[model samples]
Target: MLCPCRGKLKLLVVSLSFVILFTWLYLLVGNSENGRSLLLSACLVESTEARLLERDVLASRVREVEEENRQIRLQLSQSQGLAAQPVEGNYGNQQWVASADTGPEDAENTAEERANHSECSRSPTAEKCELIHVACVCAGHNASRDVVTLVKSILFHRRNPLHFHFITDTVANQILSTLFQSWMVPSVQVSFYDADELKSEVSWIPNKHYSGIYGLMKLTLTKALPSNLSKVIVLDTDITFATDIAELWAIFRKFTGNQKQVIGLVENQSDWYLGNLWKNHKPWPALGRGFNTGVILLYLERLRRIGWEQMWRLTAERELMSMLSTSLADQDIFNAFIKQNPVLVHQLPCFWNVQLSDHTRSEQCYTEVSDLKVIHWNSPKKLRVKNKHVEFFRNLYLTFLEYDGNLLRRELFGCPSQASSESTVLQHALEELDEDDQCYDFRRERIMVHRVHLYFLQYEYTPTDDGTDITLVAQLSMDRLQMLEAICKHWEGPISLALYMSDAEAQQFLRYAQASEVLKNRKNVGYHIVYKEGQFYPVNLVRNVALRNVNTPYVFLTDVDFLPMYGLYDYLRKSIVQLDMASTKKALVVPAFETLRYRLSFPKSKAELLSMLDMGTLYTFRYHVWTKGHAPTNYAKWRTATTPYKVEWEADFEPYVVVRRDCPEYDHRFVGFGWNKVSHIMELDAQEYDFIVLPNAFMIHMPHAPSFDISKFRSSPSYRYCLTTLKDEFHQDLSRKYGSAALKYLTAQRNI
Candidate 1:
């Protein structure tokens, strides 16, 4: 207070110091808050990463468990002895498991059974289940039948797995493929190689054999077959095995230590190789009596190692200089090769191949017919060969011919016992027959003929989600396949097509269908191939094939030539529901009509169809020519009825119907054109199935050239005679099978 200027300076300095202290305190608090936020953010990021890793691990485990469940389910199904239903979405590589029975008492045994089942269920190339490979060259329907007989004999006796490699033409391939596919034998697999692909290899060798160039296909086997095939047993279509083929397969072990031994063959049992069968028999050169090529065990690995192709070609070229052409084709060339390279052949016992050709001295090979391991009908006349023991061998062939191929699909464990029982039955049957009585007489006047159905390109269509679909079942030849697109489009539901054609036609049809815009993309059609085998058209057999394979609850049985009116498929579905058809034994008849004009626009509605009928452009199917065929439909009543109307069955009535899938099958015995459809209707009547005519549904038969059967019926007296005989026998059979019901129908027919 005494000095004013000094006091003021001191007070200002004190105020500046107080302001700096407060600012330092505020900066320290802000730094602490930022450090806490950084620590919290780091913890959250670490925690999130840990949860993500845990989720990934759980997802992986779930996937693994799912896979294990699938495997366990498959194994369990097999263990329960359930029918191996094909796994969906795996059509390219179908796997089938062998059935097994496991007991609760023995856990160890159960484990062993599981392991064995797993082994059996593995792919065809699995190591534990060694496959015995057999190859054959077969073409045409006749050849296909012969091959079936041959395979039947093998299946009847095989103890191990079998894989058949067939060199076949388009027809035989289709037939064999169809038959084998339907067979579904668990222990067997089949593969078909087109014979046309191999023709160029053997075509140049001039062959005068009765079988033509097809016989020469054997020479190309070394190149035709898979390179990985180490060994194979090649058999002729005409051969029948009397014992297990495994015994024949055992011959391959004999080739061991002998590097040159490439083939196991039986010596020829005839004097033809000795050049003594005829006065001017200039046979190909042979070592002694030569060797038969009918039953050959080829060491494919050894043959390839020795360059078999070059060797056979050289041999053929050398032999061709001396001879103009090979009379025996494959047999001649094979014998010539073996003659030059004798060390390459291991001679199989004569009983292994008891040849039954006309000139055969086969009695010297076997003491009795029972001693025969493989019977070879190496003659054009086949069963009528001039052998002294023709009846015994012929009967043996017939036994296999009449064998039910379905039996071959029985479980592997049951095969040996079943085969033994069958053999015993056959022996007893043969003993009871007279020596002069043929087991099967080709000339017998029989109504029913043994025909195979669904011989190729078999497919099963998936049902719609609602399961209220109708399957259109029909039969046709290749020429009629042109109508398939229209039929399929109009139906718009699943179509079960039974195609009857030769092998060449099948190939053509497959190619055409594949290239077609409509046919290729359609998955709703099931094309069941029935090979046109016999002279007369197997119309009923084809119909049955299409009829039997339908997966839907209802089926519309019609011919391929007949086009259903628009909305027929939808109408049938609605009618079935409205009429409660699933619970009834009634057939919904679709009235059929025909037109003489080759190219008429198909009517889309029933009114339009009736208009066409009124204009004389269309008439009831077989109206003037065979009124009896459609008269039972009662068309006059059908036109007036708003709802379905009942019609009394009449003789020779053959109206198309939409019936339950379980309806009486078309009698397959009434083959060809005339009586096929009528017999089916007669059986339906015998079974007491009600014939109800649908008011709206109709079928229009498109005019085409007459079928071969119709043409033959018009031209040949023998054909008509056969038809008459077949009809009589059919009537007798129907009377016997259906008893009083059939007799009543027959009485009504006679009165008519």
Candidate 2:
């Protein structure tokens, strides 16, 4: 009954379907195993070629490394003025300048060093003189200057007649030198070398801090000091001084002619930093030695007799050849001299050269030794510390004092005052810090900790076999509870801490609300645990929970991921009370944050890619460096310099942050974590909490949020991770050091 056309159409449809079915079958039938095996075979053949290429690359790398070693050996030979020795070199060319230049950590402006830096009078009423002859060094954003200042403060502030012989590369300074010179009937003889005098002789690439820089300054100081002068304290500019300068002078005076030599303080008794320059490649630091350059009390007579100045100058000159390869400068000469017993060495009080923003503040507070002579602000946060208003003002004023008459006559008294209307406007932005800020004695004063603490929030989400989001909630709860216990047990002050735990876990961790006596007797550790069961908890809820919990006099909300170092208790106890802002009493007390297992190197194959990733944007998701927590509070625009979000910037774990108690506890208006942040924190009491973040203790994250690859962490205490040569512990003689406590602990943890 069907028409001929309809029958044909049906037949065509069936035939097309059959063809498609047969083709699919053909594809499925051939490769089932055999086709795959063939493809894999071809892949293996191609991979063999790849392996060959990799081998060639590796062989090329080995040759390149060998060449680099040759160059380094050559330079070291030239420095020592010896025939090139092939006894395998360690600090090859590229690692030469790897030494950090940010200066000493918690570097104090001691009265001793301050006495020599006479331009700035600490207090008008305070007696500012001590009879210490000189302590000199050149510092370009380093801890060495801090050490100098600390010694100066102790020596001079108490009215002891002290002359801090500062030989700076910066020749023209007015505020620190001339301004203060105008104020006092005092003598702080600052002998700043004319940069122009050596400009022609200096190489294209000038040496950074501590690079034969010390050696050059030493030479200059030797010439400047009187020939009869018995001694000189040659600090590298990073030490802190808490004790009187007279004590150190006494130590020098007590030493008989038979005893006095070049005295350098040593911190690490062992062959420390063995692989730092060599990167665990081999035969490093073993080629030389290690010692702390914080303070070096030199017997100038011995120095002159030994031609120490010549030694430093020659070494500095040789360092110029292989500039890119070396990380350390004058430190190397110090090591070589010390090794030969050319100078006497002494171990000073640990606190005198204490690394500022250290973790062990609590333990350090009780150690009864000389007051901190120099605070070495040596950690990574030197720039941040320098950015402080107090430090900035003081440094700016000092720079002006140290300003050369020529530059000032041209800039200040000449045509335009740098402190102009535009500059005044820039002051609020911290854009022109050098223009307006006044100089002061930043070290002699101790920072005080208030009653409020800002505890940050953290979460780790890992779905189980059941695919429930609740796993994260449990971890957050347990960690928060642990933090509470730790605070209750260790924290000495009455603090109100706010926490922002996200409800990423579907499981309700709040069930254990009263499990731990979070604050114990303390009233301020606020309990604002935010948990959203199935969905991402609204950022509003996260903040609100913290806001409602703060009932104490002050409040700060921070993350739970931070593990405080030993000194945190004291740092908080002391630094918090120093804040001049009103929020010091009611605003956020943001503590410092540092990451554990931080490494600078990445996979070569993925270098550009990782760079693209790490250089990602904060709020703009397109750029790869954007971490989850970098977004604005209300998802507002970024690049607002004065905003709280921008103000909160630091290299450490900012996500695990802190906030003030009086600031809006929670901005519930925003649905998620980052919204309404800048306006709320900065705009609300912009002047107060805006600058609340302080560089105190280094809070280490044991198992931090946004976890990283664990396998990559060092299996040993090798400093090779940061070095260029991939050297393990440098000294070949240190066979037993491999089994040290630190290495053992690392191994145990890796096994765990």
Best by TM-score: 1
Clashing pairs in 1: 170-503, 171-503, 178-455, 178-456
Candidate 2 segments whose C-alpha is farther than 4 A from its true place = 1-130, 138-152, 155-159, 170-172, 185-216, 224-228, 236-238, 257-260, 268-272, 276-278, 281-289, 313-325, 342-351, 356-372, 383-752
Full-model lDDT for every candidate: 0.73, 0.37
TM-score result, candidate 1: 0.47
Candidate 1: lDDT of 122?
Answer: 23
Q: In terms of lDDT, which candidate is strongest? A: 1
Model 1 RMSD in angstroms: 33.0
Superposed by TM-score, candidate 2 places the C-alpha of residue 3 at a distance from the truth, in angstroms, of: 99
Per-residue accuracy of model 1 over 1-752 as CA lDDT, tens digit each: 01122234444445444434444444453358775465566557677778568657856765665565565545444434312321110112223343355333233223223322333222122232457899999977567757878998999987778889999997687677767664556667788888999999999999888899999999999889998999999999999999888878875765663667888887787888889887988788887788899999899999999999999999999999989799888999988988788777776666667888877777755556776779998887887788778898988887787666656665565333223333345446555555553312212212222334443332446677765688998888877878988887778888888887654466578778878888877776877666544455667767777887778988988888888888888899998888788777888899999999988888877788889989999998988899989988888876777888889888888889888898888765555657888888888888888998998888888888788768877997766676656667778888999886678666765676
List the candidates' TM-scores in order.
Answer: 0.47, 0.30
